[model samples]
Target: MGVRFSKFPLCWWPSSIKSNLHDMSDIDDGNKNEKDHLPGFTEYSLDQLRSTTSGFSPDNIVSEHGEKAPNVVYKGVLEDDRWIAVKRFNKSAWPDSRQFLEEARAVGQLRNERLANLIGCCCEGEERLLVAEFMPNETLSKHLFHWETQPMKWAMRLRVALYLAQALDFCSSKGRALYHDLNAYRILFDQDGNPRLSCFGLMKNSRDGASYSTNLAFTPPEYLRTGRITPESVIYSFGTLLLDLLSGKHIPPSHALDLIRSKNFLPLIDSCLEGHFSNDDGTELVRLASRCLQYEPRERPNAKSLVTALTPLQKETWVPSYVLMGIPDGSASSNQSLSLTPFGEACFRRDFTAIHEILEKLGYKDDEDVANELSFQMWTNQIQETLTSKKHGDSAFRAKDFSTAIDRYTQFIDAGTMVSPTVYARRCFCYLMNQMPQEALGDAMQAQSVSPTWPTAFYLQAAALFSLGMDNDAQESLKDGTTLETRENRN
Candidate 1:
């Protein structure tokens, strides 16, 4: 077997962290001096264990993680009488000290409810222990899926996605931290189903892509083949998580990336849901998940965009009075008719257009009735612009005018609109037509994040990933698409 050693590169560390890590790196390689590297232990050792790990034991085993790793975790009371979960490091050859120190340093700077907070570590001789706050419910992988577990409700599933993404953003925005690892088993679900990103031993600062195989579903085909830890790789993993949350499928040894990459992702929702969720929200979640899985790392959005994109899928928050002057156009009136009240009759019967013309001459675009309707203007000006460009882009795509189409669609997306999905869909279609498979998948996934119940959005993503040789994931996408198709037909 090939042996490997890992360290967060000094260059990648921010100045604040570099100062703290300098002294820790100086900790002599005592085990190496005393003897050769142990067969089962990693570079981590007992001497390097954190001081906070005063008391830890096997009796505290809270719950087993997934099949991905064999770290036996224990939830125990420290000597100080605080509750903590301790995970035993599995490597027998290298010392546990290095991993523990890395986690400690990471924990020292990172703090968010979405991420499990490290309580301490216990490294005595060969034994390595990670003491963390004990979460009541186990990891999300166990509950939402697993052999006999009940499926989560749609609301809970969306909450998990939002909370989990927030956690990733929390990590990504750190001065020098990113969740290089975000597998399902590492995602813990609280009683309310809010997620806490746990397990950091494998969480490395080095972007060299963990030099090992993980659940294939979480690894993009590129990473699977190249063994590179990249930002896009993390997005791929998160996208797999979205699939699992939506379909309740685990990342099998072979994988699940392709499974949910279909046009009919609606059927991927839990059957128990009995069709209870808002279509718009569901579509958004599925799309967001797919976007995170773009094969090319650069094409995927960073965590900030993800959070901003998924915010609409969350529960209602109060909008300030000033925030919304009025509802968007279509929102105010139904398809029935615009009955004129006495005041309205006076307004409409008059020379409104002529008055608007005068106002325009006076340099008041706002005076126009249509301009006052935010949704109408958005749909007409912005959405229509996107649609128009997208139509032109489609023709250009068939004619092999890829560069021109990409430019056209890019402009449409850059020009703001009310809905994220509208631009996402237009841009996604544009990318696909332009022969940019990665960009197609990225933008399509973004569209889904804005509207998950829509199978078309999901299917578009499946087509993109499939074209790029992510065979396993493509297969899954087809399956999800089929499921949604059947459901739509039944409807």
Candidate 2:
């Protein structure tokens, strides 16, 4: 038996939690942590990560450059409803597991409001992954260059520069002085639209030997000459980011410096930012950028100095980031809650009429495998029997015959000829309708087991948990379902 550790004894847990834990324990065997790590740094399992990210579906990918990126990052939701960003390194990226874990542990220890903090790492077998808090708004690249709503306001751009400087300063203070490829894409906006630096770039992909992905001209001068990254290299990269924020596009550091030297700033500034910033404020920012891009690494200002220089330049100090960016404030209760789907709304309102129509509209499409199998396996009596039972259960479900639906679904499940999450989900709703909260929870758990990433299973669990009076747990489950549903719709 695996050694299990819990802060509280079994008797201390609520009856609902205890029962759910007992029912789901067996399904979690493959998701156990491989080994313990530093305090507060979780060592997640491959299986758990897979389920959280829907087997790393391409549709859930959040990293820029798509498949071509050296490492791909996906957005996922944890069981407890926390959103996470999972970074899966390339197969050959981190060949040394020990080195990978050490690096992860070191970076995981440092946390601040300025960063998308690292929460966990998975290093089981050949897989190497890092998990961090998800930033919802998007990257600086999108907001600065590819904005849909509007160009990021001048005040927001200044805030980004200051925030990034503070983040680098925090890392530097924590003894992690070097940050790889500090670019606009490396900066992300959290749910509140506040900018935070991604922690993924803190860990070097050592095995690859290539550190910088962008143009060599934008890279630190020392790195170009010796192929080595230093603390000053990060500052040099930071200069490029300031230029990106100011110009609304990438400007080669050399070209930008010459423009600054000649006092010809009009061509370097973004047209979108024409009247937003004063000439004096613009000149001050340009001078700071020049200092960061000095030819000699030693002459470059450190992270602390950058923070010092940029602190006084902040605009709209009292304005919230969301307001400045023209986005909804995430802290607002209305924005915090996700908009429910039609089927989800029907379930939430306990509207049997709308539920029946949705079920009919959905039909067996959710169980396409079962429909396809009948074409080739009609001669097999077991397959035929299983399909017939499911059809009957679905009919009963749509007809609002909860008791009959339960009986038919039970028969289909016990047969073991076929497995379908949709069957378990439909039966779960039936159990809820019949006021069998425990049975509803059981069926919902089973549906999750059958299809580990399905949002419907989580939604069903929320309903059952609510009926059981586990209000907090029900809300968590509801949030998890909403998160998964959002990802599915994006696909």
Best by lDDT: 2
lDDT of 2 by residue, 1-491 (tens): 12121122323322233212212322222212211111267899999999999999999999888877878999998897778899998888788999999999888877677888888999987899999988999899999999887898888999999989988998887789889888888899987678999998899656874788888888999998998899999999999888998899899999999999899998789998888899988898899899999999999999898888888888876566887899875644422455777666665556757765765676556565443234455446578788799888877887788899999988988877677878878887787788877777777776666565667777777777767755445555665566677777887
What's the TM for model 1? 0.48
What's the TM-score of each model vs. the native? 0.48, 0.61
Error of 2 at 308 (Å): 1.3
Tell me how far the alpha carbon of residue 161 in candidate 2 is from the true structure, in angstroms, after superposition: 0.6
Q: Cα lDDT for residue 468, model 1?
A: 62
Please tell me which predicted candidate would have the highest TM-score against the true structure.
Answer: 2
Q: Which ten-residue region of model 2 has the weakest summed lDDT?
A: 29-38
Per the 3 Å backbone cut-off, how many clashing residue pairs does candidate 1 have? 47
